[model samples]
Each structure stands twice: as structure tokens, then as C-alpha cells.
Target: MNAPIIIGAGVAGLAAALAAAPRPVRLLTAGTLDAGAASLWAQGGIAAAIGADDSIDLHIADTLAAGDGLCDAAAVSRIITGGPLVIDSLRAHGVRFDAGLGLEAAHARRRISHVKDATGHAVTTALAAAVRAAPHVTIIEHARAVALDVAENRVRGLWAETAGGLVHLPAAAVLIATGGVGALWRHTSTPPGADGTGLALAARAGAVLRDLEFVQFHPTGLDSGATPMPLISEAVRGEGAILTDETGHRFTDELAPRDEVARAIVRHLAEGHRVRLDATHLGAGFAARFPTIDAACRAAGIDPARQPIPVRPVAHYHMGGIAVDARGRASVDGLYAAGEAACTGLHGANRLASNSLLEAFVTGTDAGTALAGEPDAAATTAPAAPPRRI
Candidate 1:
């Protein structure tokens, strides 16, 4: 019998692969498992209700506020309640987060767990390592899914572009954790390969897509002329970095929700002002706290500790994609999605900072568990419909 096939090798896919353990999984990646995934580029860390003052209700409230009234209440409740479990699971897989939590923009409490601003790298590395060591998981690098093959309204297999040219991979189940579509925009903080391929494939397979218009433009993308712009994490602002216009005037609250901050930057730029993120006050601690941002700024001929870093709003996270249920099951049978590629309505119109990684971990694990049950289970035939948009 064919094993389950998972597309994309980011955190979501890796988590799914592990959770679907003992049920052989073929994990496909467009590049080396860890190299091109947006998860590796994430710097803000994962948000969880793990702090002493934090609670699942608080996390849910914050996420709903950041989502701008479009989040599904039940979905938000489910995911937020599962946040600590996700963090514990990651820790169990050898991912080390900081001993203490830190605050991010718009959060009422300090609840972000990180590894010196390289949280994504830490989590992805650990998950990938676990997946690689799993006897039932097969990592297929450089295999990009081009389309899904559906028969009788259910996915039967998929067509992929491999080194050996196009190949058909049949599967009893297919999971799409292909990340986001940030690459569609010229100015983006996503890797070049994040072109929403999974969304496209799922749509072609008759899966319902959701909230495609609600792209989340990050407020602190480094304007260094890189194709996929480098991100200056929101944690920098939480740690006292400030955004300024050409005249060094602070125009908006640096800790505002991303949509508000990004709009402020865009408005400034449109009014003939250059927006800059000034971390000069951070001094030497800047390098230690955010080595990634510091190195990126230095590479672009700027220094975060010495001067303000030029920044602009760039397409960062997609607040929408192939809509899925709490279990990451898409509307179509045999199709599941997680991560940025799947919209479970946890992030409605805007996403709260650092929640992306948490959602990926939770939904990925849930999807895997669901798929691991009953190989001959009957599939749902609901038409592609997301929860009612707010």
C-alpha cells in the first residue's frame, strides 16, 4: 500500500511526518529540508501561553484582536489552548528555547519562546532531525509537487517535478504544508520558492481557497535590495527599537499590530519620507540579542547598533490559503494542509506576531494524528467552505 505523501519540508510538514509515525510518510521538499523553508528565516520566535502571567484565554484574545475580527472563535480557542503542548512537544524533539519568555508587538504579556531570535531555525532543525531519524519517514529532497491527482472527488496522488523529470506519486493520503505565497509580491520577506504552489495545486484539485486578499505586510523588512528581503523582527521593537521617518520622528506606536505598523510605514514612504528602524539605542546588546538582524544589516552596509536600519513594508505572512478544519483537513477528501499554506482561521485579517510558528506546530500535529487513524476510513465530501468570514 502507498504511504501518505506530504508536500513541503518546513516545520508543518516535518511535524506531520513525525506525528504520522509508524505509518510510512513520503515528505517532499523543493530544496534541502532545512534550507529554503520560510521557517528558517523566521526570527520573532513562537508565541505560546507559557509565561507566568500568560493564559490560554489571554493568548486567544490577543490573537483575535490581531486577526481584526475575522478569526474563528472555536479555532482560536482550540489552537491557543494547545499552544503550551506544542511548545513542550518541540522541546521534547530537542529544540531549545530561551529559559525566559519575551514580549512581542501587540501581546499583552511576554509569552514568546525563542532561541536568541533564531527560533525558527532551532525548531526546524530539531524537527527535521527527528523526521530524518524516523524509520517510517522518507525525506525526498528537490521534489516539488506540481498538481494533485483527484478521482471521485478525492486526492489519489500528485504529479511532482523531480530530478528525473515529472513523476506521479500515488498515496493513500496527501498533506500540503507548502508554506505561504509571500514570494508573489516583489517586495517580500519570504524565500523565492514561497509562491503559493500548494494553494494553486489545492485549488486545481477543487479545494476551497480563503482570504487570498488579506496578505500580511510585515512592518520591519530590511530594504537591502535583496529579492526576498531580510526581516527585522518585531522582537526588536519589543526590546526598544523604534520606527522613524526621514526626520527621525516617531509616527506610529512601534508595538502596534502588523497591519497598523506596515500601513504607517507605507504612508510615510508615500509622503516622501523614508521609514527607518532605529535600534541604535540597543548599542552592543543588539548584536547579542539579534545576531541575525545585526549581521543582515551589516551585510547591507548598515549597522543596527550604530545607525537606523532602512525598512519598508514587505509581504511577510499570508493570513489566508487553502482553508482547513481544526484537524487541518481540507474540504476535499484525502487532502490536508497546515502551516502558512493552510488557513484554519486562527489568523483572520492580520496575524499576531510569532503566532505563525505556533499555528504551524499545532495544526501540523493535529493533521498528522487525524491521518494516522484508520487507513480505510471514509473521507468527508463537503464542498470547500471556510468558516464564515467576519
Candidate 2:
């Protein structure tokens, strides 16, 4: 029998495959299951209102504020409440978080659950491992999806370019969890593969898309003459790190919403002011708290503990994608989008820091759960790209 197909084996795709459960699943990734995903580079933790002093309402308000009050209140409340449950589900899958929650900019409380500074690495790695061991799931690595085979306004399957050649894969449903469009920009902090491939597929298939105008720029990317700069996570700023100009004058609020900070840096740079992030106040303990970031800094020959790291604004995340409902279903039937590929409207104008991971897991689960109750996938003569014979 044809199985439901999930594209891009990032956190969202892994979670969807796991949640689809005893139902057989076919997971397709452009690279290996463990590589090329932008999710692996996530340094900050996932946001969830599980802190003792935190409440769902406060989390919702904080998210809205970070989003510049452009959020959908209903969707914001719904998705934020799924945080604790997402944590619980991940733990059930053998993923262990750090002892305490982390605090980031725009949060009223410390509600970001993490595993050190490598939260994305830790979380996505665990989920991918669990997916590997799942009995009913089939992982197809290095198979880049080229197009969706939509006929009569419904998705039949997709055409992907595999190692041998282009082939048509039939599925009951298609969930696009491919990451954001950050890499499309010249100075993105995202991996090279995160170039809006899935978003393009959705557009080609005529899926409803929104928030395409809301790309976010991170202010603290290490400007180390790198192609895709390494991110100096917001958690560093939350921990008393400050942004400075050439003469060591602080230019912007270290903990403001990302857009404000990114704009400040850009404007300052346009005025010929050099920017740097001084984490000297954090001292040597910075390495203990953020080993991954410390390593990245060291690789660039900068000791963040003692020196001010060169910084600039770079494309970070996209707040818009294929618009989806609460169930992560997109405009087309038998086609769903999750993670950074789907615009659930939880993120209105901008995404609150670290909320990306939570959205990935929650939306993936929702789409998979919704699919569990659906009928089996139907077989059809799907279309292939590059004039390949099917």
C-alpha cells in the first residue's frame, strides 16, 4: 500500500513520521536524515510556557508583542498551549532536555526548554534516531522532491529526483516540512540547503501562501567573513551580552524583539558604524552555558568570553509559508505543510525567539494525528519533472 509521504527530515518531518505511528510512512529528505537540515543549527531552545511563573496567557501576549501585534490571537493561543504537550511527547521518545528552562528576549518568564546551546542538534538528533527505529516508517534519503502531482485539485503524490534519476512516488498524502527561505538571501544564517525548495513545490501546486513578506533578520550573526555566518543566539543577549559600535558605544537594546535589533544594526552599519557583540560580562562561565556557541566563536579565532565578537544582521527565519489551519492542513486536500514551511499564523509579523522549534514539533504532530484517521492512500499516474518517463 502507498504510504503518506513527509518531505524534509527535519524536526517537523521526524515528529510527523513518529506521530503517524503504526501507520506506515515514507519520509523523503534531500540529504541524509541527519544532515542538510537547517534545524540542526538551532542554538536557542524551544519556547513553551512550562515555567512555574509562566502562564499560557503571558506566553501568548509575549508572542504577540514580539510579532509586533500582528498575530492571530486564536491561533497563537492554540499553538502556544501545545508546548508542554510537545515537550512531554519528545521526552516519551527518549529526548532529554536540560534541567531548567531558558529565558530569551520578549519572554515574560524563563520558558524555553533546552539541551545546552545545541538545542536543535540535541532535539532533532534524538527525533531522527527514534524515526530510524520506527517499524512502520521508511526513510528515503538524498531524494529531493521536485514537484507535487496534483490533479483535479487534489494531491496524488510527488516527483522527486533520486540518485539514479527522477521517479514518481505515490502517497496517500504529502506533508512538506522543508525549512524556510533564509538561504535565498546572501547573508543568511541558515544552511545552504534551506533555499525554499518545498515552498516552491507548494507554489507550483497552487497552495495558498501567506506571510511571504515577513522574513526576519537576526542581529547577532558572527560576521566572520563566512558564506553563511554562524549565529550568536538570542540567549546570549538575554544573558546580559550587549551590542556595541566601533567606539564601544551600545547602539540598541540587547533584548528587544529581533526586528528592532536587526534594523538598528543595519541602520548603524549604513552610517559606517562597525558592530560587535560584547559578552565579556558573562565571563568564562559563558562556555559552560553555551558550549556550542563558544566552539563556533573559537573556530573563528574569537574568544567570546574576553573579546567582542564582530556581528551583523543576516537572514534568519521566515514568518510566512503555505497557510495552514489548526490541523496543519494546507489549502489543498491530501497536502499538509508543517515546520517553517507552514504559516499557521502563530507568528504574525515576526516569530518570538525559539518558537520555531515548538511550532515544528506541534504542527508536525497535528498533521500526523489528523492523517491517522484518514483512509489509505490511493494509487494514481503521477507526473514527473525533466520529462522523465513514469
Candidate 3:
């Protein structure tokens, strides 16, 4: 059987490769690992239902409530119910989640998986390693997909530009695991290359894209001198950091939903106020617990241990993308999506804390099973490259 073609080697694509490996798969990525994808910069943990007090129903309800009015019930059910399985899968792949933090607020119990504060990095590292070990999986680094190769209302393959030359790779199936459109905004935590490529590709291929306007803005992005806002992981605040303004007056509560917190931070900025990350409350232990945030604060000339680190709201994740069903199948035949690129309605208008990685794991495996169930067929070659346009 011909290998399935996967685009964008971020968490979603890597997860898909690991699940479908040894079964014929070619993974294409635009840049070196950890440089362009938001997954690498993610510092929080993964949401799950493994906590003794938390129920799958509670997590689903939080996710649906946070998503606002656009969440899909069945999709929410699938992800919420699948959370424990996803965590187990990660552990099997060598991920070590934090212990003894029973379900956080908004949760009935503790169900988040973590490896210190670097859960996303650990999960991506493990998934990438697993894929690398799979001989059936082909890795094409520095290969940027220009567009989806579709013909007669069906997906055939993709057109990509590689370091060598323009190459047309055919495949029995295509998975668009490329991430969000965070680049559209001026200040974003998304990889610069993350500009709406996935959306453009899916839309060009005649797929239905939804909720493009539901972009999520994360509060507490370091306001120091980072060109693209560097995020101060929510887990820090969850661990008791405070949000304040320059005068040292508390502005927004740390526990507020992300959208509200982001909007509030933006409003403060427009009012000429400087937002601050009050890690003084967390003490020297702050740097010990969240090394990334500590390093970022120090690099920006702020000693978070002694004073507050300046912060602002920045575009983080997209709450919408190529619409898909419960099994991660796109509306188009022979095309599937997982992770950030595919919106299965688990994250409504806003995502609950640490749920992004969780959704990726659950849907990636589902997409793999669904893809493997397809009939064997010959792959169609990609067409000639077209002129690039924004």
C-alpha cells in the first residue's frame, strides 16, 4: 500500500505519524523542529479526566461552556471521554505527568497530565522520537507545502517546495495537521510561518472552514521586549501568580477565563497601563517551577522573583479551522485533520486551560484508525507549483 501523506510536522502531524507508522506514511515539515510551531512553546499541561474528583462530564461541560455557543456536543463527548485513554497513550510513549494536583478549579477533580511545566515539549519530543524510530515513516524536513492537491472534488496529495526543488508527493490519504492562523494578528505567540496556511490550503481544496473569527487571545504574554509576545504559562497563575498593573494595583483575577483576561489586559494597555506578572507571590520557587517563564523574565530584564514582570494579551490559538466530524474526518473524502488545524468543536469560542494538547492526542489516534480503514489505492501526483500569494 502507498504511504499516507501528512503535512506540517507539529504535534498533530507527529502524533498522526506515530499512530500510523509502519503502515506507509510520509511526514512533511516547513522548518526545523521547535522553531515554528506553537506546540514547542506551550508551557502548560494537558487536560484529562484522570483525577479522582474530576468527571469526564465536568471536563466536557467546562470545555463546552468555555467554547461559548459553537461547540459540538458529540465531539466534546468524544474528547472528554477519551481523555484518560489519551493520557495513558502518552505515558506509554514515555511522557511523565505531574503527580498529586487533583483536578484544578472549574474541574471536579485533577485530570491534567504534566512533566513539570514542560508538558507540551515532552509530549512533542516523545512523539517525534517515536516517529523517527518507525522505519515506515518518511521525514521530509524543510519541505513547505504550497497547497493541497485536489482534483474532481477529492483530495489526491499536496504540492510542496523543498530545499532540493519542487516535489510532488502522492499519497492514498492526506492529513492537514498544520496549526492555527495566529499570524494574522500583529502580536501573536504563533509561529510566523503559522500564517493561515492550513486554512488557505483547506479552503482552496473546497473544504468548509468555520469560525475563522473566533481567534483566541491569551492573557499574560510577556510585555517586556519580545517581538512576538512570549507567553507566561497559565499554570504559573494557576500555581498562584497574580495579575497587576504598574502602580501595583490588581487588575484582573488570575482565574478568569482566557478571553476575559485577554480582553481585560488589552483594554488596560489601550488605557496606557502596563500589566505585570506578580510572581513575587510565587517567590523564588517560581523560577524553579517554571523555568521557561523565569528565563523569559530574566532575558527581558525583569526579576520576577522580586518584582512583577510586565505582560499583555497576545493572539494564541484559533478556535476554528477546517471543520471535521467525530472521527477526525474532514468533509472532503480521503482527507482528515487533527490537532489545531481541524476544528472538531471540542474547543468552542475559547479553550479551557490545557485542553489543546489533549484534543490533539485523542483526535490524532482517531484519525489514524479511520485512515487505516480506507481501501488501498494509488496516489496521484501533485500539480505544478502555483505563484505564492498571501
- Leading candidate by TM-score: 2
lDDT of 1 at 213: 93
RMSD of each: 4.7, 1.8, 2.0
Local distance difference test values of all predictions, in order: 0.88, 0.88, 0.78
Which stretches of model 2 miss by more than 4 angstroms? 383-390
Off by over 4 Å in 1: 374-390
What TM-score, over all chains together, does every model reach?
0.95, 0.97, 0.94
Better of 1 and 2 by TM-score: 2
> Regarding TM-score, does 2 or 3 come out ahead?
2
lDDT of 2 by residue, 125-218 (tens): 9999999999989999999898888876688888888989888887788999999999889998999988888888888887999989999998
Of 1 and 3, the candidate ranking higher by TM-score: 1
- Give me the displacement of residue 17 in model 1, in angstroms: 0.4
Q: Give the CA lDDT, 0 to 100, for residue 149 in model 2.
A: 84
Residue-pair clashes per prediction, in order, are: 0, 1, 7
Evaluate residue 175 in candidate 2 and report its C-alpha lDDT on the 0 to 100 scale. Answer: 94
Clashing residue pairs, candidate 1? Answer: none
How would you order the candidates by lDDT, starting with the best? Answer: 2, 1, 3
